[model samples]
Target: MKRLTITTLLAVALLSGCSSKEEVIPDVPPSNLYATAQTALQSGNWTSAIEQLEALDSRYPFGAYSDQVQLDLIYAYYKSDDLALGEATIERFLRLNPDHPQADWVVYMRGLTHMAQDRSFMHDMFNINRFDRDPTPSRQAFTDFKYLLERYPESEYGADAKARMIFLKNRLANYDLATADFYVRREAWIAAINRCQQVQRLYPDTEAARESLKLEKTAYEKLNLQKEVERTEKMMKLNPAK
Candidate 1:
């Protein structure tokens, strides 16, 4: 009986060792999924790329790669023109990492997703690539870039962010100018003046500045605002002859 009990204990220990040795560790880290997605994206296999990324999110909810994966997923969705998915991914990332180091980049990418979706009617009409009149996305892009500049001045991407902000600001100012011109053509002095004021308030240093001031002067004159018209005209005259 003693011999049998000892043999049974030895057998159990052997079984335990075999079980431990056979235990399967996960073959990949969550970051590996992101890397795979990147490869797929570069290959233009957008569907597969997104699937791999989503898998990373699902399988490793709190893994070390979560934040980075979330960011990359946003880009993947945007590259594929999956605007709704891109927006949703960004919203989720914001919820998770509101104070993340790269939060500004996330915000900028979100706006970019919307900008990508937006298209101009003129583009369709003329078979040319034109942008939409929607200033909201461009405005958001500017805000994101502005935040990066102000909060992380020493950031590696700071200069690029500022440059993009300038571009977006100019685009937004152009939209305002275009709308003001449309109002002028229709003899809508109040609307024209309001639009010009928008450019002055929102984009004072942009190329649209001088032209916007000129439009404001014409609008005030059309509305019979004598003093306001004279004030705007004086300002325009003082502006370097451009």
Candidate 2:
């Protein structure tokens, strides 16, 4: 009776272990799954949309809606603030369908994703300065937008991309100017002059132009370059902001 009791308990434990394992997900109809995902997206339920789209992709990887599912997943990831996932999804889509008719849109979204990642809530809401922040993401976004405009000049997103590019350029120039100011404070005249020159050469017509000219004048004066000092001084004088 004791041995039998032990055996019964062991059997129960085994059954409990088996039941505790995860249940296999039931197969959902692909069309229904896609529709559900679309509905979730429309309702701004990003998490739910991601789950349904992922299920659809896993179950019907080669179905008619496969491409659209991938695209929607990218957008869902972005809207959900899963920027890293969104970037990975964009790269996957580009690699898998380089010649897709909607490739331009995907590229544009990639640029926007990088830009969004570079921005902080404080920067957006409080107008906090981002000049001292990392410029890698901004540079990446600029490259992406430039690529989109050059590769797909007629893309519907071209105009907006151009506008974003302009903003990024100004930001980048300002960042360089900020660095120049730091170098000036350190009395690294050559470094400061080089940075100011870079801003003037790469980001012409930007608000940073006046600052760059002023920094260049200061650096040149410190370095005893009278010719360059006079030149930069003249440029600064012509600018109304100076």
Candidate 3:
């Protein structure tokens, strides 16, 4: 019985010593954290993955794995609903690793962020949607999508981006006309004319411009503006097909 008791006490002492050592040691290695983070990502545990990957910030500063970890960290921030951080990280990554094979993916992801946040003009006036006043996001989305279309037309997402570009073009043209119509209704003839002219300059091919021209002619006629109306009519005659 005494021998058994000694054995038990020794086993307990050894376990206690090992636990103390583990408590004092930083148990996670950079590689292990990265691997675990990847596994968590694959399982769709984005929050957990971000937590693990972010812990490797100051450690493992010079390895190939470190570069990959940073890339994955950007994705984790995006997937975990931390878009601001994700965008900043992506920009930094692009600047640091412009030649990286996956750089295109980062650009595309940024474009997607812009597209997803885009809003129409009536969003606030009609309580339609969020981000109504900012055409900046939509414009950036269009620019990026156009870049992909012109340069990487055969990319997997290129076709979809092109379709989105078409939709955005029409939507933006409509927005211009809507602004002109608003000014017209408010009897702001100069603003209305300027906006109509802007639509023609920016989106001459759209139906919105066609509609805007007709409305502009009416606005000029209402103000008894003979010269401007005559000029507009002469232009329409020159381009009869439009």
RMSD vs true structure, all candidates: 13.4, 4.8, 10.1
What's the candidate order when arranged by decreasing TM-score? Answer: 2, 3, 1
Each candidate structure's TM-score, on Cα atoms with residue i matched to residue i, is 0.70, 0.87, 0.71
Model 1 lDDT tens row, 27-78: 4776677788789878988888888877888888788878877887898888
lDDT of 3 by residue, 105-145 (tens): 77777777676556434664687733225577778878888
lDDT of 3 at 65: 78
- Global lDDT scores for all candidate models: 0.78, 0.90, 0.76
Instruction: For residues 119-227, write the lDDT of model 2, one tens digit per residue.
Output: 8888889988869788999999999999999999999999999999999998898899999999999999999988988988898788896778888888888888999
Candidate 3 accuracy as TM-score: 0.71
Model 2 pairs whose backbones collide: none
Model 3, C-alpha of 160: deviation from truth (Å): 2.3
Question: So what's the TM-score on candidate 2?
Answer: 0.87
The local lDDT score (0 to 100) that residue 109 gets in candidate 3 is 75
